[model samples]
Target: MTWITEFAPTTEGLNACIDCGLCLPTCPTYRLTGDESASPRGRIAAMRAVDRGLMPVDDRFAGVMDLCLQCLACETACPSLVPFGKLMEGARAEIAAHRPDTATIGKRVLFGRLVGFRPALVFLSWLLAIAQRLRLTDVLPSSAAKAAALRPVPIPVPSTAGHEWLPEGEQVGTVAFLSGCVMDQWYSDVHVAVIEVLRTAGYRVVAPPNQTCCGAMAAHEGAAYDAARMAERNVAAFAGHDLVFVDSAGCSAHMKDYDQWTEGGSDLAVRVVDATEFIAGLIAKGALPAAVETTEPIAIQDPCHLRHAQGIIEEPRAILRAAGLEPVEIDPTGMCCGAAGAYQLSHPDISDELGRMKASQIVATGLPRVASANPGCEMQLKTFLDDGVEVVHPVEVYWKAINTRPVRQAWRALKTVPRRN
Candidate 1:
């Protein structure tokens, strides 16, 4: 229960921060509040204070850590290469163990217990959908109202049956697809789009059965052990595949670090690739079909995980451009849409501020359709943007343009894939 064994591993990362104040301009919270405690340097200072026994792991210490979006923008700007994201995760884990408040318990129950269970999220989405249909979402609490407002339309969970879709003559590679928890439930349309785009690119797809959540939500909420458990399951589930593709930016970014969780994690991590990154590679090699042209300007809202976490800033844009859609960039620094997986519920005020800021940036581009890679980001963007403006995944856009091939009856197994909820 002591601090050393609990939080010592992150001490090196904390000590590595140079406190140069270079990250201030990049930090969303620091920019909003102008408080040192909210910036990366300030949070690291608090971690160092607790590690040195100069400060206790009290509510005040937890407050500073909770305020962080974990966007990792500071890490991108840091000259010292400090592992701020990992350090913040470790600090949050310690806070979760030492300080269990109502909000903490709520997050643990929602993220730890419910998020990974596919059945629960499916049912919750169903109920939310019903609530929206009945015009009852407004009666919900503020946080629930925000989430409810995001997803006006809910899609049923898609079956994750093993699919081996091959091109008519050529087979580029056999890749496994990750049907993430929420991704499969709420945004199954995007999954369908991903499959079509991959198939069109000559890649044979293999979606493993019995896949679980990628644990990004749990990990971000300070449940590292639980996240590790999910990682081990995924590592074993996705074994033997030459490459594993994920459309969800957060899931891809988190899974790419599976090596830190258990044995053979790095093996799985290396094989993991974002769908945009993979399709963009196909475009680069001229293996995919001709670009499907469009004249409408498409505003690109880069997901923080895609841009900052994985350094995949251009692949989504590249894919959009190759599809003949005009790609408009907003916030080159990859500002977070504040949808850090249940962060809106945990930190409603800050989440709203960041979400509004992101929506405004997209609106300023004067585009009606905005392309993003993450479902959470899409939801966040939709929540704050005008009702007519569509927030869709870049893959969805790419799928629309190049998907001229008819659905082969054999590949239509997913159409009737059984639903549990």
Candidate 2:
């Protein structure tokens, strides 16, 4: 303990680990490798050593950190309640500042630019979607292939199509939506479903005229300057909204943490809210619009961020039940579907393995279909889904349940879907 004097992690709050190793079993990377070095505890140690100047941040160190899913399961498991998420972000930031290499350079380029701008991000997604449909991925190398496979078939952003604003029926509240980078292009259906549900619930939803990416990609990858700038821009863009809702867990986590990201900087930290937080608060207040019945038994996978990061374990399920679904629990404590950010692509073997296990767990529940609140879990579950299994976001299912009159059309949407169960 004496060795720790000056250069602790800039992410702050790393001393909470206490070397308890309580988080190892819960971490997917730790479970797969059976190496403590891959666990949160070991990573913290490496981070500590690097901070103390006893070790240089080298290729091996980056590899260890890279292997992490950043799922935040470890944070939930800790009794001392360390902020491992921030620590990891800081560790990455430190790495990014000093070790700009060929390996991470492309990511810094792609994700940095994607979250930093809206027009190019949307256009790139459209191209990727076209490429997917055209089978154009065949020409790509292994690295690019990995990126494409993890991505959903991209779709058109509704905003550029035109300002499809929600009805103005004496707004009960105002909400700004985070049409995230990948979520915008690949999982447009989920975003659309969220909007539909919000509008139906009687609130005027606004896609903030000046809003941009939520900066999650850059933040996680350690592009601090770029991520901070994105945050600052969002803080300015989202000035007057009553609440900000982000459906993607990755984005939700980042948005909620904007207060932390700009602890001493931005003044808009108080405005950020995860989509579920807003939706749940709406439901609790009885401001939400009433919906129809969905008697179908629905299985739910709580994304680690939705569950562990924001303490939003019950809102998605509550909305499901309130909307008339059976609300079956796939895992009461919730488990990762193994799609931790870029995990499914980076470590396909382990990602697939964890996803298969989760898929099996969902299937075993004997539920007709599964629902998750986050787009990543939905996509991950869909990738290995066997026959008789269907995946959806919670908002999609909830919206479909409104009214015994039976809506003329299904409310939910997805890209590259095979067929409905």
| TM-score, per-candidate, Cα-based | 0.90, 0.85
Q: How much is 261 displaced in model 1, in angstroms?
A: 1.6
Error of 1 at 370 (Å): 1.1
Judge candidate 1 at residue 135 and give its lDDT: 85
> Against the unseen true structure, what C-alpha lDDT does each candidate score?
0.79, 0.71
Clashing pairs in 1: 259-266
Clashes of 1: 1
Per-prediction count of colliding residue pairs?
1, 5
Q: Look at candidate 1 and tell me the lDDT of residue 42.
A: 89
lDDT of 2: 0.71
After superposition, candidate 2 runs with Cα above 4 Å error: 1-8, 135-157, 160-164, 263-267, 289-294, 403-421
